[model samples]
Target: MSMTVNPASVVDEGEFTVRRTIRIDAPLEKVWAAVTQPELISRWFGITRFTGASGAARVGALGTITWPEREPVPVRVEAVDAPHRVSYRWCNPCLGEPVPTEIDEAHSTVFTFTLEPVTDGTQLTVVETGFETTSDPAADLESHRGGWDGELDKLVALLESGS
Candidate 1:
C-alpha cells in the first residue's frame, strides 16, 4: 500500500519563502552571537575586520564592511530582532555602478537571516533579496548563491568547532 501527502497541503506558505535552511550543531544563542558580534564577524563573513560600536548584539546597530575585493561599505542597522532575525542592506562598489541619485535601487538590496529554534539546535536561513536585475544577472546570483552556501557552511563549522 502506498499513500502520499501533498507537500502544499501541510507546509505554511510563509515558511516556503526560504530557499535554503542550514542546520548548525549549535544552540540558538551561540549562533546569534556569531552573527551579531562585530569582533567575531571575520570568523564567518570573510571580512578582515568589522567595526560597529553599537552592533555588539543590539538592535538598530550598524557596521562597516570590508571585503578583499573593494572598500569598506557602510551598513546601517535596519532591524535587529535578535536570536531570531537580523536584517540589513549591503552594497559594494563591486555590486554595480552607483545608482543615480533619483534611482537608488542599488542601495536597498539586502541580506537578511532568520533563525528558528529547532530540536537539535538552530535552523538558519539566509535570504539575499532585492537583486532585481535587468541584465547579465546569471553571474551575480550564481556567485551569491554559492557564496552564501559556502558562508553558511563556514558558519556551521565555526559554531560546531566551539570557537
Candidate 2:
C-alpha cells in the first residue's frame, strides 16, 4: 500500500524545533520497534549502536549513530515511553569536530519520536528541539528540517515496504 509522506516543519517560537508527522502503513508495535531498536533504526536512518546498560534504548542509555562519510555522533536516550514515545539528545553541532565522548547538553538537540495507532496503520511524529543551543540556530534548524524530511521518508518507505 502506498503511504503519504509528510515534510518536516520548523517551529521558531523563541526556540527552534523541527516537527514532522507521517502516517505509515504498519502496526504501532512495528513502528515503535523501528524507532526504538538500534538494529531497526540503523536500517533506515543511520548505523545506530547503543552502549552502556544493555545497549538498549532507555532513560540515560548512551549510543552513537554513524552515517556514511561522517564521524560517529554521540547520543543519549533522554526519555522512553514504551511503544509510544522515545526522545534522544545528540551533539549535532559538533559534527565536523572530533566526536565528543559524551553529549554536551549546552550544544545539543533532542529529537523525540511519538507513535500512535490509526485505523489502517500507525501515525509517527518526530519533534527535534534545542536548536537554540547550537552554534548557528538558523542553519541547524534548516538542516534538520531537511534532514527529517529525508530521514522520515526513508522510514515510511522501509516500514511500508513490508520487508
Candidate 3:
C-alpha cells in the first residue's frame, strides 16, 4: 500500500523542535513493538544496544545507537509507557563518532514517540525538543528535521512491508 510521507515540522520555541506524525496500516501493538523493541527499531532507525526486553526502556536506561553511515549516538531513556509512549534524550547534531557522553545537557535533545490506535491503523507522532540547550540550535534543528523525515519513512515502510 502506498502512502504519503509526512514532512517534519520544525518549530523554534526559544530553541527548536521537530515534530512529525505518520499513520501506519498496522495495529497499536505492532506499532508499539516497532518503536520500543530494539530488534524492530534497528530495522528502521539504527543499531541499538537495547536487548528487546520488556519494560527495559525505563528512565535511566542508557545505550548507544549507530545508524548506517553515521556515528554512534548516545541515548538515555527518559520516560516510557508501554504500547503508548517512549521518550529519550540523545545527541542532536550527531556530528561525529562518540557523542562525548550520554545526552549531554548542552548538546542533546529529548525525543518522544506517542502511539494512538486509529480507525484503520495506528497514529504515531514523534516530537524532538531541547534544541535550545544545544550549541548550534538552528543547524541541529534543521538536520534533525530532515533526519526524522527519513527515519519515519523507513519505519512506515518497514511496518507496511510486514518484514
| Candidate models: Cα lDDT each | 0.60, 0.85, 0.79
**Where does the lowest 10-residue lDDT sum fall in candidate 1?**
2-11
Q: Which lDDT tens digits does candidate 3 get at residues 1-74?
A: 68646656556666578888888888899988888777788889898765344544666778878876776778
Q: What lDDT score is found at residue 86 in candidate 3?
A: 96
Tell me, by TM-score, which candidate is best: 2
Better of 1 and 2 by TM-score: 2
Sort order, lDDT high to low: 2, 3, 1
Give the poorly placed runs of model 2, Cα more than 4 Å off: 52-56, 94-98
Encode model 1's per-residue lDDT on 64-108: one tens digit a residue.
666666556656556788679987665533366552222234544
Greater-lDDT candidate between 1 and 2: 2
Q: Give candidate 1's TM-score.
A: 0.72
Candidate 3 regions exceeding 4 Å error are: 13-15, 51-56, 94-98
- Candidate 3 lDDT for residue 47: 86
